[model samples]
Each structure stands twice: as C-alpha cells, then as structure tokens.
Target: MNIKSILAKPFAKTVVAKIYRQSNNAVKVQQNLMQKLLSQAAHTAFGKDHNFSEIKSYEDFKKEVPICDYEALKPYVERVVNGEKDVLWKGQPLYFAKTSGTTSGIKYIPLTKESMPTHISGAKNALLHYIDETQNADFLGGKMIFLQGSPELGDTNGIKTGRLSGISAHYVPKYLMKNRLPSWETNCIEDWETKVEAVIDETIHENMTLIGGIPSWVQMYFERIVERTGKKVGEVFPNFNLFVYGGVNYEPYRNKFEDLIGRKVDAIELYPASEGFISYQDSQDENGMLLLVNNGIFYEFIPSEEFFDENPTRISIANVEVGVNYVIILNTNAGLWGYNIGDTVEFVSLNPPRIVVTGRIKHFISAFGEHVIGKEVERAINSQTENTSISINEFTVAPQITPVAGLPYHEWFIEFENEPEDLMVFAQKIDESLQQQNTYYFDLISGKVLQPLKITVIEKGGFNNYMKSVGKLGGQNKVPRLSNDRKIADELSKFQQK
Candidate 1:
C-alpha cells in the first residue's frame, strides 16, 4: 500500500468517529463553541462594547448584540484596517479577504490568526470525512489541482489582502503540498485567462486525481484541456475521481461539467466565504451540506420572513426548524458579532443540522410582489433544461421595469453551449416551469400584472466580459442569478453593446 493509503486508514477512522459524535450532539457542540468564541474575544473592543464577558447564554448574547450587516460593521473593520489592535478580534488581522461589496466598491473582511484554522481545518476534515465515508484513499496518491485565486497577496495597511481562496492557499498542509498543482509563480499571475492557460500547461500531463474550483472556472480549464489534448478529462487523467467545488450552486452546471469530464465524478460541496467556513458535504447519502457546528464560528439564524422586520427573531441551533429559510448570522472568533452574512439557508435535518443554501438576501426579485428567490429561479431553469438537449454556459435574470415599448417583464440573459432550435419555445417553458413552482409568480402572470418573461441570448463570454469590466473577473465572483434591480441587467447591456 502507498503512504497515503496507510496514513488515511487511521486518519479516516478518527474523522469518521468524530463526525458521528458531533452529529449526535450538534446543538451542544454549537453552544460550547459560541461560549468559547465569546470568552476569547471578551476583552476586544467589539466584545467590550457589547459586554461579552457578562453575556453567559445565547439569550443574553442575543439581547446584548444586535444583528448587523456589512455596512454596520464598516467602522470597526476600518479601525482594524488602520492597524488598530484588539479592535474586533484579539489582535490585528493577519489578512483581509476582499470581496465584491453590495453597498460599497469592495468589502474587506478580516482574517485573523484565531479564525484561520476554521478555514484550513474545516476543509481538511471535510475531505477526511469524505474519504472515511467512501473508503477512497487512492486519490491521495496523485496530485490535486485547486483552481484558486492568485497566491500573490496584496498588502493593505500592513496586513495582507486578497481573495479568501488565495489566503487559504498559503496554508495548504506541507504533505499535500507535494500533490498540489500549479507553481506559486503561476498561481500569482493575477489575470484569470493567463492564469488558467498556465495552469493547463503545468497540470495537463501530471498525475491529477482531484480537481477543485468554482465550477465555472473549472469548466473553462476543462474546455482548454480538451482543446489542447483532443481528449475528455477522463482520458487525460484517468485517476481523477473527485471534483471539489463550492462558492456557487452546481446544479445548473452539473450537466456540462459531467460532459467535460466524460463521466460523472464524486463531488464535494463546501460553504466557505470571505468571513468563515460554514459547512461541507460530508456524505454522499444526502444532498444537504453538514453544518460545521464545532468550528470557531458561532451561527445564528433569522427566519427570512422576519429578516426585514425592525425586530427580527434570531434563533440558535436549538430552536431552528427544518424547512424554514433563514438568513444566517455569525459571531466568530474573527470578532464579528451577530453579523448577517447576506446568504439565506434552510435546514434539511435538525438532528445533524444539514443545510442547503437557498438564496442571497440581496439577490431576490420581488419587483411586483411576486417574491422569487435564487433557489426558485434555479429550480425553474433546471426543470426546463432537464427536458431539453440545451446546455447552459451562464445565465442571470433581472426585472425590466421600463421597457421601451412593452409591459414590464422578467428578462433572462443566457449563454448556451448548445443552443436550442426554438428560443421562444425554450423561454416559454422556463416561464411555465417558474409559474408551477412559485404561486405568487403564477398569480402575477395570471392576473395580467406582468408580461410574459423575456429571453435575451447573450453571446459567448458576455458574462465574463461584464465581470471583467466591473473588475470582478475571477475567484469567488459570480453574477447574481436573480435581482430585483437592473444593476446587473444594465451592465450586461453594456457588454452586449461592446
């Protein structure tokens, strides 16, 4: 047996045991984690301001600290950015994970020494659990390519600043470093197109067993590899049995990805963000990702129905019920207290507390009281596309409130790898599918309050060009699948014009 196989035997056994123990008592684990985080940050500026030291229970913590969004946390983040020690966390942050902002040009989320382990260890344990469950240790014998952002980190106020993936790349375990592809020089190339090309050049001939990336970019890399080698991914890397992905929903891209690989591979989904590592897909038995309860981050859930209320109800893991869409809140060792991360999720199981990411709070469309979410929209598209041979490259939906010469309607901008024979028929099917899913949407169309959905066939690479123009071309960047406003729709128009 190989060294990896030998090592994985013991490691996988340990992780499997831990998973069982944790799953059995997730609520207790989460409670203890919250207490530990609060204790660690008690003396920090934010903690002191919130009386964290005296806050002894979840109820007390909830009463003391108000839920805040990025805007509400901006001042404290700025203080940390200006080299203030113990402002949010215990010390100055080691780095800032920069992300596209909702209210501002960019958001700088602090990545502290205390919180870094949550990202690294959580990711490692996820894979370990997968191996434990599958008994698949041969993957460790070959290289694993992670298509991440540039490893060349930029400095902001004496602290490193970059994409969360880039920061995490700096800390890959030394042993696995041997099996990782793309030299540090190639990883730091900055431009995504150039970086992808370099990655393909370096990894095409290697003994690759695993590939991890945001599905869209990985698809681009796969396309390039196919072009160069004149072979499907399975032919090039027959040992490749795993595809690890997150950051965006994979359902829409599932068909195309499998086609590129020439067969379906085992996939592991992760719920990682600039703020913290939240969850991961632990077992192939279920679709929901297992929440990382014992991780450094403490989680709170506010029901999406109550999220917009002046006094929204924030509930702990003990009280959260299955099937309720909740906007996630975090109180992390990184010193964020009751901070709303903007994403909405629904619990699929309460015993182990597995969750499915439902949508983003900012990415919903309620333009005419027909509340439509990302999950609903994606389901509609998936249902419509599953019946046809067409494959989607990328898509985004927006409300066209003021069309030049027609009633207001929901517009879809789509780029297809295999175009349908009849575009109008395809569009009608999507609209009908959506109506079947959302009663509010169905009522709007039936009441003649809205016109039929409009479809715009974007040229290949239109979304990428749009993201590039807005300086958000790669890494965790993705177009909002659905939007109430026309910001994304307007930008896509500019790309079409060019």
Candidate 2:
C-alpha cells in the first residue's frame, strides 16, 4: 500500500456539504435548517430567489410540498431537455438521465453542473471509505472496468440519448481518469464495445486488478472475455483487488459471479443516478449501506405501508422508522426539492440509518387481482426455483386477458439456461411459493379468479434482443424480474424464430 493512499482515506474525499443525521438532537437542528433551505429553494426555483425561510419542522415542509414522481413532473423534464433554464433548475441541465418507469414512460431526468457534484463527490467518498474499511489502499491503483450501458451517445437531433451511465464520460475522479473505462473523446458504445476489449486485454496481459459495474452486464463482459481468452475470470485477471456493483440488488447474481471467478471477489455497493450518487457501501463486509453526509441533500422516507399500493409515499425523513420499506424522498442542491426518486428501501438500523434498497415501487404488478411486489416475487422465485439446475436469465409476468373468459391469469415468459420438460410443474411450484408469501395471490389462484398460470419457455437470448430492440441498455435497468405487466413478452418470444 502506498503512503498517499493511506493518508487519502479521510482527507482526500471530504464530503462537500452537511446533511441531517438521524438523531433527535440532530433532527431538531436540521428541522430548522431544512425549512429555511426548502423555503429558499422555492423562491429560487420560482423567481422570488432571495426571500426564503428555514424549514422549521418535517411536517411543515411536507405540507408545503406535493409528492413528485417522474410522471407527475414530465413537463419539468421536457423543460430540462428543451434547455428551459428557469422552469426546471436555476442553471440549464447539461444532460438528461434517461430512466425508464413502469407506468410513467421513459424519464428524461435532469442533471445540472451545480447538482452534479453530489453524485460525483459521493462516489469518490464511497471509494475512499471502501479503501479505508477494507484496509486495501492498493486496490485504488488498479484498472476499473465499469460494466455499464452501451456507449452510443446522443441522437444527431439530440431527441434520443444514451444511458444515465454514459454521463460518466464527463465526470470521474480526475486522478484515476486514465485507469477508468470511458475515454474523453469516445462515445459510450465505443467505451463498452471498443474500449472494453482493451480493458479485457489489459486484465489478461497487464495484470489489471479492479472490476466495477452492474453484476449482469459485468457478468456479460466476463462471459465475453472468458470466451475470447479461453481462461476463467480469476485466472485471466488474478490481481483483481475489488469489484463494485450497484443499480440493482446483488442477491440473485452473487453466487453465479463467484462460480465463474473461482474466487470471492471483493465488492462494494454503489447507489447512483443520472442526477446523483446518494449512498455507497461505506464499511467493508457490512450488510448495509450508509447515507453519505454532506452529499448535498435532505432526504425523506414515506413508509412502505403508506404506498404499498397507493399514489406513492412522499414522507418526511424525520418520521421514518428503523425497519420499514419507504420510498426515497429527496431534497438536494440539484434544484430538486421534495422529489421522489421512486426507489424503495428499508432501514437496517436508525443510528445513522443503514438502508438496504428493497426494490422500485414502480416495478410492482397486480394481475391476478392480487398485488405482488417485486421483492415478494423475487423471494418466491429464489426459493421455489433453487433446486433447478436450469437458470432463469430473464422473465416477466403479465395478465393473460382472455376475451372468451372473464378471468385474467398470469402469463410468464421465462428465458432459461437449460430448457426443462416439466414447465407446468415448475409453474405450480412457483405459484405455491408465491401463495405462501401473498395470501391474496393464493386465494385468487385457488378460486380460479384467474386462469391457470401459463409459462412460456423462451430462447436463451430472447429478452436481450428484445431490450436492444427497444433501445434499453442490457444491465440492471432492463427486465427487472417482476414488472407492471408483460408487454414485452411478444418481443421476448421473437427469439424462437431466430
């Protein structure tokens, strides 16, 4: 380990702003500060600019601001895309982070220069803190392969844009700029398709030592590298000091990653957005991720029950409990005030509140007259399908509305590793498992309120092509296990003819 990396831990990545800690004493102090800031932002965002008051209480702030999901504020997003400065943010948005919502069409999220520092600084702090916790400062010196979205930048007319990840081209640690994946002049596709080859080649030949990215896409790259090099992940890149992944839960993909690598790869969780990186896994080997302080925001959590199947919770941060899943409500320097990021999370503890991202609220489905949340579906699938050697690569469940029959049943499109003969039996097991967690689904199924659940086994790369055809990137963002409905099932089945 180098001396500079040792000294850099606490000092190098200093947090740029002060955030409210989750303590009553601190809450009291922050409540006063939050009101003043929120009031001030209102004036600034709405043209009064200077006459603003400090936030006095969480309740008061909540009453003043309405909940905002991306759908509710599409006009504001359009303003940012059209470069409308005053309506969206004080400054013109430099880029739009294209985030896909289940019901609310594709979101062209806004990001400004002033607002941009939150994610950048937070990510840096996360890396520094990871090094500090793992006591592996030397890990910082290795090449990092960000298994991110395709690199193709913007459409010629600027109407279409790349993944939120493509923005990493503009901001990364200036020092590690050379070691990072994307080049200054190259587009995102080149970064992924073209530059990725160099990263793979270097990992094999130059002793590359670090890997970071979303697990699925990262796994894809690993598969490609393995296919090309004829060497396993660990043997080809033995010096890999760490692997960082985020954007989605690592539970389902973790063991597969280990199996391929032939070793336990050190990993850190990254919670990033086109707008910002809110929290990073601070402590090494810890189960939870800490909220980065001074990361330019006041955050809130609307209780899970408040939004289990409602309009959505835009609750206050102070009112949040220790072990509840709540949708993230954020007030940040990025000109976003009382904004709902749409991500659902649960607190592991309240003392400085360590949170685990539960899932997205938008990704829930209610097909068989029973609302099945993403996590519930995931839990059922993980448990019921554990014994099967055939792996489900991508899948979605939709309501099969038969005009002849009034009942609408769940139709599943599953991409499997190996085709199983008893597909109906597999569906029954999963149905049974789902029934255990959600009584409503079981009741509906048993009463024949919905038709018998149908499963259509898809070709291996069916969903992958479907997403590519839709212009969605092929990582965590695509085909989340459970979705609102299976609109893409037809597109998924297109691979059978291929």
Off by over 4 Å in 1: 494-498
Off by more than 4 A, model 2: 3-5, 8-33, 39-42, 45-55, 74-108, 149-163, 182-187, 190-203, 308-314, 384-390, 403-409, 418-429, 450-454, 473-477, 496-498
Task: Give the per-residue Cα lDDT of candidate 1 at 268.
Answer: 94
lDDT of every predicted structure (CA atoms): 0.87, 0.64
Residues 14-71 of candidate 1 have per-residue lDDT tens digits of 9778876887798888889988988888888998999999998998998889999888
TM-score of 2: 0.82
Q: Give me the candidate number with maximum lDDT.
A: 1
Model 2 lDDT per residue over 273-349, tens place: 66567777767666678765345567777775676555555655556677677888776655666678878887776
Worst 10 residues of 2 by lDDT: 15-24
RMSD per model, one decimal: 1.8, 4.4
Q: Estimate each model's TM-score.
A: 0.96, 0.82
How many clashes in each candidate?
0, 11
